[model samples]
Target: MNESLHGGVGKAQIKLRTQDFPIKEFVCQHDPLYIRALFLQAKTEFLLLSLDLTSLTESMVYDLKASVYEEFNIPIENIWITVTHTFSAPHLDKSYPIFIKKVKEAVQLSVSRALERVTKLAISTDSVTTSLNCSRNIETPFGWWLGRNDLEYSNHDIRILKIYEIKTDHLLCVLFNGDLPPSVMADSYLEQGGKAVSSDLIGYTCRKLEETVTQTAIFILGAAGDQRPLEKSCEDIVSEECLKRNDLHEAGFKLVETQGDRLYEEICSSLVKPNPIFLPIKAISIYEKKVFLEEKVMPIPTKELKPTKHFDFSKTGRQQELTIAGVSLGSIVLLGIQPEVNSLFGEKLRELVNVQTVFIASMVNGAIKYLPEEKDFERVTYTAMNTQLGRGSSKQFLEEVRRFLKESNLSVDKQIN
Candidate 1:
């Protein structure tokens, strides 16, 4: 075995406040979600355990990468972070200086804790259940809706894993699936505080899951760019309360208090087996795919067009996020792609990779908008503008993936081949 290439192991943790009271909503309302940083260190690698604050923004992601990289010596791609898409949390973008300061400090503290935690732990892999889910039920004119109007469709299979210690049996991390979109509290009044924040859901789930086992379980949201719970109902209320330790705010704080203990107890009893150790840690590969672009500015229907002409998606659109098939290995075989991929993409990638257990994950690396089917592009829905990335965008992205796979020397269809 290469001395420098031993198994990469790491652990980290951070806790940020998930509460914010922005008296009024702004044009860029900060999605309320607690941002937790889980840092992991293994051999020569250092990764940041990022929990979400509402949804992820390209600029914010870039900021995190830059800050973490500058503070700690690590490769950019190695520092992976994800959001829980909690809507009821605090918004760092709010104008209230106090709110912003509180959030910044909270994030910093979490980051520091993560750095401290990562240096003190070992890493073991374990698989958990793919539970606690259902497709988003949007009441559309055409009846209940899930994916875009695209002819191609796909289903999301939520996956989760635990990263923890060997001796003390502390759960240092959790890797889970699902998009953390902050759509749950779409119409929440800031003072009322009943906005849906996903971080609490993840944190509560993790904390509860931890009690069930001996380790800390952190959640990494899966391909949920397009997945969101419809309406802020009792279910969401119960889910959010799972994370509240105390009723600080007068708002939804009491929501979690109602059955928080009961739910936590339930999670404690639902302990599953841990993931197996990752042997002979091989290589990690990343690929970027671009959805094709349209040469001509697709004209919008007169009725659909906003008077201001801002591409009124209320009228028409196309799929925004698109990528070719993928193959990854760890606890299971992962066929990854992005931008709310069609169900067919997962099946096709499964065939291409030919793994024993194929898991399809969307929004793995970065998030594109949404990728509708070609036919939907023709009809021009709200997603069409983004999905139509010109003529050869999809093909170009495929080529990029092929090149990345070959260069990285990651295997595909090892069993079949």
Candidate 2:
């Protein structure tokens, strides 16, 4: 079941003119926000609800899960809720109780509708290349800055998981897992009297795909902690110059349209191809690890004094339990981890797994700051500085995932023999 949770006309919104505090007035909606639920009942029954929101808190996930289980009698563990990480969407806050109510109602409606018309599913996977994203960590004369890092390693692969209705062979939902947010075009609206809220690239892509397929389109953010959409094309001298000269208005729209069209073409082509391997859906495995933070020695400043230099570096025995969730669907696997994971970790996992397709959905379950690779600790990058997990925490987490995948593969081989 799919329903809109759009906060409508006048409401407090997030990621729009953030400079303005206590935003009371509402902005014009460019597109509707949605909550799409896809219920599966093959070897195992489960519900995957995708939200077009900025982010979700752990408490919200727990509440949504409890509500669904209590009403539908489905296991709480069977529910998987993910967000598109749309910067222009609303964030949960005390000021918006009505918005929360609408979300709960939408989830129930979507689940009920999905349960009513349960259909056999056929899955196909494809990829598309887009010049939209780049690493945001750049090295400057003073220090490393959070900007466009063209030389840094970033995932440009846009993995598409197309779920189809077996009987009619119609597209049910298309899950777009990419390392860029749809806020490129919407951010351009900021200078033009920041009274416009839009889904930007993502919403536009979905609308275009729906025009032909008439199906639900879901966007899941990948490891984009250090990644951002290209603000300017190669033809442009600089992003700020384009924005200052009002060139971004036209260029940004064209880029969004071209990229959306390219993705749509890929989806159409993949749908026509035959021989999609359907794997029996397996149970999801949740692994939890308690991570402890340790104090690091700060280097004395030789240049101007920074605020961080004055802060006390003390380990107050701060600890967090990180959860890693893995679900296997034949050769394709979906791994969801809490917090914003770095692209490097995702790349390493893919190389180790060697699967046909492994969709690494970041910011799942809960947000725990950033999860950067062990090597990232060497440099004072934004992700490393903002992370709660220790230096080797990411490596340890990846090892656990690799072990689980290996054990599962061995068990399947033995059963086959």
Candidate 3:
């Protein structure tokens, strides 16, 4: 007989209210930051930890894994750590080492609280189609640039996972998959010594969910390498050169806040569903497939690059190779990729995986950079131009994920447990 599934959820604030370091002393405070953890217990255990900050570091990651392993015998591979990928927060620079130290302590406490409260928890899956996000890749007279392009490919579908107590039937926590970076204020004028540490969309919206809903909400980045908030912080981004350099994108705090409010309202539609369909998670397991792609993507001349409207995805969509990893909670499979992926690729991979239900998250494990679609290589979109990965990289990534899912028997590697 399989071991019964049990889960616990815990969250602790980073107490950013009085923090002085904000990368360049440009940001001060908007709301308190937090680190949340969800512990899944079974024959094999997994700790899913999410941070509100911008990203993670090697020392911070390894140290937390070591600490968790010391406290609980779960292996390092089973401890999954992902960030909200908020762009307006502090950057990983000279002051990161100190800030990360505090993050480590709070994260450890949250994990401990979760582990201590292991109880029977059931999961229900639902999704909401939203227009809060749009494709950021646009065709410039100069070439592909970073601008709002609603006509192009954009992922409006957001996957939601609700964890509820099996005994009381009360919702315990919510895990929502964010398709884009929480970067609405990414290029804002906050750089002009604005004393405010904003969480942008992901942080702002999720924090609201926790406060109003009164349940822990953990955010996981989905295929959002090319997606951006429909309401961008600044306006009139003219040149591709300026966009790439992060030079001219200006600030509009009101725009980002409005976007957050819109996203929060839309997500609530899915959250407050009259009834939810829970997955049969009798057993839990994790799987991963690694591909060694060393060939660097050579750059195409900007003048020769094509625009977004020129390429037809139906005819041009192709597959190639990439590193794919995932975990199975019974029938529902949660897959992850390390690089930032475009919205179309995310949808394509989900369709090909052949699973009854699957959620593909990007920037998982760690963030390598952007992985634009195959045709983007020919067109040299902003992503295609900036990514160090070579042509057909995204296609290859899809092909590998397809293979991984098939071999894993619906994309889940069955092992000890």
Candidate 4:
């Protein structure tokens, strides 16, 4: 690999209509959220791009990659596309020809604008107190797990990233968590409407964060596979409908005032403008080798298993890596386990990376479902109990982290191992 390839980071945020419904479940459905793109560049070249979309088909990724490569001549591997996973958006999978054309145009506009306005900036960090959310399933006696989707079990914990201009007092990125599962309104409603497509909580959170911070904020949806709104009950979807709109608007404003002031104070005292002392830039990559599930010792069921809420396992010795990329400004890493990752996993990653003064930001690349530890996995719930991937996956991931560090030649403290 070209180790000498210097990384020059640049970011651009382009706002589009908030609603998108590329696919409709029934004959008719409406999309509700607009999309946004947070483009990142390294050394005047593309490194990663986060497409905060309402919804779209998997093929869109390939299509986007092909288009960007043809036009900009950037390698496909250098680009990473992620959805905010907002439920209240369009689904390109089922949209009409006109709609698809519109989507492609919107995406291109965002990309072009972002790439055009790239600049160098410094990033600061802060954290909010953990909210009350958690996992809801556990293992069963038969070596399986079961559980339900409960909002109370969501990961309320979130970190705030303050992207600042090196010389000026301007803000660049306001990154926060959008772990609320994508159910703003049901698919039935999403496939039909297109009044004002936009980014939901992810957008609302950023808009709110920007009011006070004087910089742009980009919200990323974290590990929220099994988490849902407690208030979004089965019988009454109306309440959820009402709440979704209200929350988006209110949080947009409140977050600006409250979080902005708090972050401003913290950043002012902790940081200085115009080439503040450079922070350490540590980038580590870990790859764990293991047999694919197809090659597992146990036979996977021929048919996809029925959905179960709980998660549990009985396998041994799997390989997965908890990789970390620590920059002077912050930490970005891939989580080894499932989407519904808990504080425990966050704590473990921090321990492995072993950074004294830094913020923890996870799911930087892709997402697995929810991953509680072995003991909690046994308790079984919607995430842990019913995971299609076996319990051994967690152990494999942990081992991979160990192997990854060793392979990278980054000295590992005995305590972390």
The positional error of residue 224 in candidate 4, measured at the CA in angstroms, is: 3.2
Model 4, TM vs. native: 0.62
The alpha-carbon deviation from the true structure for residue 179 of candidate 1, after best TM-score superposition, in angstroms, is 6.4
| TM-score of each prediction | 0.62, 0.78, 0.85, 0.62
The digit string of per-residue lDDT tens for model 3 on 206-254 reads: 7888889747888888888888888766644666454343433334666
lDDT value for model 3: 0.72
Give candidate 1's error at residue 38 in angstroms.
4.0
What residue runs in model 4 are displaced by over 4 Å at the alpha carbon? Answer: 1-35, 39-46, 54-59, 90-101, 130-156, 178-198, 210-215, 229-340, 356-377, 384-386, 405-417
Q: Rank the models by lDDT, top first.
A: 3, 2, 4, 1
**Model 2 C-alpha lDDT per residue in residues 1-417, reported as the tens digit of each score:** 111110010111222233433333234555566677767654555577777677788899989899999998978876778877766656777586666776777778777767776666666678876667788776544444455678888888889887767667677777778787665553344334443445566777777776677467777788888887676321212342221223354446566677667666755666566776554444433333333333333333423222121232233455567666666665667777777877776776666566678888887766666776654556656566665566666766666666655664512211100
What lDDT tens digits, residue by residue, belong to model 4 across residues 102-134? Answer: 656655655665566655555445555433234
lDDT value, candidate 4, whole model = 0.43
Off by over 4 Å in 3: 1-3, 17-19, 57-60, 191-195, 239-251, 297-323, 411-417
